[model samples]
Target: MKSKKVKESVTIMTQIVLPNDTNPLGNLFGGQLLAWMDLASSVASKRHSEGIVVTASVNNVSFTTPIALGSVVTLEAKITRAFNTSMEVFVDVWVEDRSGKNRTKVNTAIYIFAAVDENGKKRQVPELIPETDEEKVRFEGAMRRREMSLILAGKLKPKQATQLRALFE
Candidate 1:
């Protein structure tokens, strides 16, 4: 499989937060934002693998700020790394003011996707190539995140998580 650059799989989605997508407080609902993020990241994963993919796990999701209704929401997702049949996607959520003047990052998340065949069996994905400095950082960090995930899932022991243990050493 040929290595794919992060830029090649980057996905950007923009949407306007409507009243129906907001909470009683007029802020964008957490679940709504999560759904949008999932969709955006799925596009990135599919672009990278060029095959069917399913969300394996959401490693992290942080809603740092409340996005008000009527705000423009933009999601950017890119493949950070690929491991055999799975790939890590990093998503950044930005909120634009009603006036469309300012944009602020309100959330970020990491999602893992597993490439699948028509039969729903896991399929191998091509490796990812980090072209920019930021991509390189995310690519390296994905390894540590993957190690910790496996450890927490009981698929790996702490002693076997060398990538995660390196953070403390």
Candidate 2:
């Protein structure tokens, strides 16, 4: 859209569980929740980059609890670190039961996204500004993981590359 820059790219997304999203166990479908998380993370990355963003990779997604049909799920996503054309966003999933007293962290992940231009080519993304200690820690952690992904994907030499690459070779 615009070549704008955001000091930070982060957002919180939430959804109230609906009957149609529930499974036979009367709990929300894990797939559905994951879908929501993906969408939210994508949007958060875009907010920082100010362009069309695509998912490059998602790392370490773990579900620690199930969401009941009547509960509300909140997904917090923020751009952690950004390279020339890629940004890593950290996401944490939380659930609030209908009772209004129990809010639990149920899922967490680090998703990588690439900002793209209208021609569908990858482009540089905006930088991130960490405002809190927690944000700083998460950003630093994401950087480490991003480096590992580059090596695992062969974008960089697993043994020698300090910067993460986008390809395995």
Candidate 3:
């Protein structure tokens, strides 16, 4: 398979927060935001894999600010790294001010997806080449995140996580 650039897998989505999408406190519901993030990340992973992809895990979702009702929310997702059959996606959520002149980052999340064939069998994905400085940093951090995820899932021993261990050493 041919390698693809990070820019090729970028996905952006925008939504207007409505009353039903928010909580009684008038802020967007966390679950609603999570759903949007999942969709955005899935699209990004599919673009990178060029095939059906299933979400394997969601990691490090940080909700820094509350999005109020009537806010214009935007989600941008990109493939940070691609492994044999899996890819890591990063999603950023931004909320625009009432005047639409300013935007603030409200949330961020990381998602892992596994490419699959028609029969639901795992399939290989193309390598990802990160060009920009931010993309390069995210690409490098993906290994450590993956290792940590594996350890948390009990699929890898703590000592076997070379990338994570390197952080302390």
Candidate 4:
């Protein structure tokens, strides 16, 4: 496993689902889960930069299971990549059984956030310190997506990365 810098200050803060956050069917609301994703993503961005982070996009949400009330809904977040002031955070929501038994993933998604200065101008984000093989794999995934996004945005001209950079830059 390749060990890289894992930001110790990276926190999963201010957000965990509790019993009172459940719905009529005793399942936690999906919107609430998504909201927690945003929080986790912002925390990851701040951890990477300690600057104001604003969400730029959310890729997709896949719900593999329902979240039961009274169960622990934990949102784990990590910065898989950084570009200029933008940081990509991969978040996963899991449910810990009431008996403290096992955990199951309920949802997964990717979030993009841009760090800004006090005047709201974009600023540079700190580099991500990947610590393990898992982190390295995640970093590669983020980089692939970033490249794909550039291609889709017409920023990365096919077969001419240098030219594309010069043009876009």
| Residue 98 in candidate 4, Cα distance off native in Å | 2.3
lDDT of 3 by residue, 1-169 (tens): 8999988989999999999998989999999999999999999999999989999999999777888898999999999999999999999989997789989987889999999999999999999999999999999999999999888888888777787876545
Residue 45 miss distance in model 1 (angstroms): 0.4
Clashes of each: 0, 6, 0, 1
> Which lDDT values do the candidates have, in the order given?
0.92, 0.80, 0.92, 0.74
Alpha-carbon RMSD, candidate 4: 5.3
Predictions ranked by TM-score, top down? 3, 1, 2, 4
- Where model 1 places Cα greater than 4 Å from the true spot, the runs are 166-169
Residues 1-169 of candidate 1: C-alpha lDDT, one tens digit per residue: 8998998989999999999999999999999999999999999999999989999888788777989999999999999999999999999988899898998988889999999999999999999999899999998899889988777778888877777776545
Kindly list the per-residue Cα lDDT of model 4 for residues 1-169, writing each as its tens digit.
2222546435564344576777788877877888888988788777677768898777767766877767777777888877777878888777787776988877778888988999999987767777789878988788667665667667666565533454445
Scanning candidate 3 in windows of ten residues, the lowest lDDT window is: 160-169
Off by over 4 Å in 4: 1-4, 13-20, 148-169
Q: Assess the local accuracy of residue 50 in candidate 4 as a C-alpha lDDT between 0 and 100.
A: 75
Candidate 2 Cα errors over 4 Å, as ranges: 1-8, 163-169
Candidate scoring better on lDDT of 1 and 4: 1
On lDDT, the leading prediction is 3
Q: Per-residue lDDT of 1-169 in model 2, one digit per residue for the tens?
A: 3333233556888899999999899998878977888898899898888779999887888766778988988998877777779988778888999997999998888889898999999887656666678877876777678778876677757556555433334
Query: Candidate 3: which pairs clash?
Result: none
Each model's Cα RMSD: 1.6, 3.9, 1.5, 5.3
Off by over 4 Å in 3: 166-169
Residue range with the least summed lDDT across 10 consecutive positions in model 2: 1-10
